[model samples]
Target: MRIAIVDYGMGNLHSVTKAFEHVAGDDASIVLTDDPIEVAAADKVVFPGQGAMPDCMRHLEESGLKGAVLDAARQKPFLGICVGAQLLFDYSEEGDTPGLGVFAGEVVRFPKERMHDEAGHKLKVPHMGWNEMFIAREHPLWQGISQGERFYFVHSYHFKPSDDIAVIESAYPYRFAAAVAKDNIFAIQCHPEKSHNAGLQLLRNFVHWDGRP
Candidate 1:
C-alpha cells in the first residue's frame, strides 16, 4: 500500500510525514510529494496544512493539485489535518476564502465575546495546546482511541458542518466540531502529529482502514 501525503507548500509536511512513517513503517510506502499524479495514484491521501486559508487555497490551485486532491478525496480514503480540515468545507471566514467544498460547512472564527472560559479567563484565538475530543459518532478512526482523549490543536478558525457528519466535538469555551467523517473522508481540526500516542494510533488505524466508514 502507498500513502501520499499532499505537500501543497503550506503544510506541516516533514513532521506529518514522519508520524505516518512511524505508524505505517514498512506496511505502506509513505511519500511526501507535491506531484498531483503521485497523490492521485496513492492508496490513500493525507492532506495537511498550516497558515492562513487564502494562502492555502491559492497555493493549492497554483500548484495544480486541486483537481487531483478533489478527485482523490472523492474516490479514496482521505485524511485532512488542521487547515487541511478547514479547507474541506464550503467556505471560511478567514480571508473571506472559499474551500474545496468536500463537505457542506463553513469555517468560522471563535466569537470574541465567547473566547472566555467559564471562569472569565481569556482564551487565545488560535486554540493551541491539548484539548479533549468528545466522540459524537463512531467511525473506524476512533477505534482504540479513548473518548475524551486530548489532541494537540492550533487553530484560530473552526469548522461548523451543516451536515450531520461531525463525529467529534471540542470546545474553546463552547462546543464546536473537532472532527468530521463522511464516507471515505475523515478530517480533524487538530494536529495529530503533535498529539503523541493517541494521535499515532489514529494514523495506524487510517493506514489500515479500507474506506468503509
Candidate 2:
C-alpha cells in the first residue's frame, strides 16, 4: 500500500511514516508530501498533528492540500491522529478556529465540571500514556478489537463526534470520541503507532479494512 503522510509543516510525519513501514513492511511505501497532487494520488493518507488546531489548519490551507484531503476522505480511506482527528470535526473550542468540517461537532478541552472517577481525583490534561479502548460499535476498522482493549493516547483535547464512532465506547474520567469512521473517512484520537502491539494490530486492521461505512 502507498500511504501518504501529509507534510503540512506541523505534523509528526516521520514517526508516522516509520510506523507504517514497520507494519506494512517492504510492500508499503510511505511518502511525506506537501504536494496536493501526490497526496490526492495515494491509496491512503495519514494526517498527523503534533501541534494546535489553528496552525495545523492554516498549514493545510496554505499548502493547498485541504481540498484534496476533503476529496480523499469522501472516497478514500484517510486516518487522522491526534489533532489530525480533531481537525475532522466542524470546529474546535481549542482556538475557536474553524476546522475542515469533515464530521459534525466540535473539539474541546475536557470540561472542568466533569466528575472524577473512583477516588474522586481529577484526570489531568493531555491524557498521555496507555489507555484502554472500548469498542462503541462494530466495524471492519476495528476488525479484531474486543471490549476494553488498550491503546496509547496523548492530547489535551478530544473529539466528540455528532454520532457514535464505530467502537463500542471507551472513557477516561470523562467520555470522548476515541475513534470514528464515517464512510471513507476514518479517524482515531489515540496514536496507534505509539500504542505498541494493540496499536500495530489496529493499523493492520485499518489497512485491511474494506473502508465500508
Candidate 3:
C-alpha cells in the first residue's frame, strides 16, 4: 500500500513520519509531500499537524493541498492527528478561523476560567502530557487496544462533534472528544507518535485498516 503524510507546513512531520516508518515496515511505501496530486493518489493518508488553527488553515491553503487532503480523506483510510484532526471540523474559536468542514462541529478552547481539577488544583490551558482515553465506540482503529489506554496530548482546543455518536471521549478534568470516527476517517487529539507502545499499536492498526468504520 502507498501511504502519504500530508505536509502542509505546520506540523512536526519528522516524528509522525518516523513513527509510521517504524510501524509500517515493508508493508507500505510512505511519502511526505505538500503536492496535492501525490496526496490524492495515496492509498492511505496521515494528516498530522501542530501550531495554531488559523496558521494551519492558512498554510494548508497556501500549500494548495487543502482539496487534496479532503479528497484523500474521502477516498481512502485517513488518520488525522492533533491540529490535523481539529482542521476537519467546521470552525474553530481559536482566532475565529474556519476549518475544512469535513465534519459538522467547532473546535473550542478549554475553559480558561474553570481551569481547576476536582482537588482544586489549577489545570493548565494546553492539556499536555499523558491522559487516558475512553473509547466511546468500537472500530477497526481500536483493534488490539483496550479501553482507558493513555495517549499523549498537547492542545488547548478540543473538537466537539455535532453528532455525539462519532465521539471517543477523554478527560482532563471533564470529558471531551479525544477521538472521532466516521466512514473512512479516524481522527485523534493525541499524538500517537509520542504515546509509546499504545501509540505505536494504534499506528500499526491504521496501517492495516481497510478504511471501514
Candidate 3 on 31-142: residue-level lDDT in tens?
A: 9988898998899999999999999999999999998998888889999999999999999999999999998999999987878889999998899999998878888888
What lDDT, from 0 to 1, does candidate 2 have?
0.79
Candidate 3, 118: how far from true, in Å? 1.5
Clashing pairs in 1: none
User: What is the lDDT, from 0 to 100, of the residue 142 in candidate 1?
Assistant: 89
**Candidate 1 residues 128-189, lDDT tens each?**
89999999999999899999999999988999999999999998889999999999999999
Better of 1 and 3 by TM-score: 1
Best lDDT among the predictions, by candidate number = 1
Candidate 3 residue spans exceeding 4 A from truth: none
Model 2 lDDT per residue over 111-152, tens place:
776747778887777677877787676777677666788888
Candidate 2 matches the true fold with a TM-score of 0.93
What is the Cα-based lDDT of residue 21 in candidate 2?
78
Q: Which candidate leads the pack in TM-score?
A: 1
True-structure lDDT of candidate 1: 0.94
- Against the true structure, candidate 3 reaches a TM-score of 0.97
Location of the lowest summed lDDT over 10 successive residues in candidate 1 = 110-119
Off by over 4 Å in 1: none
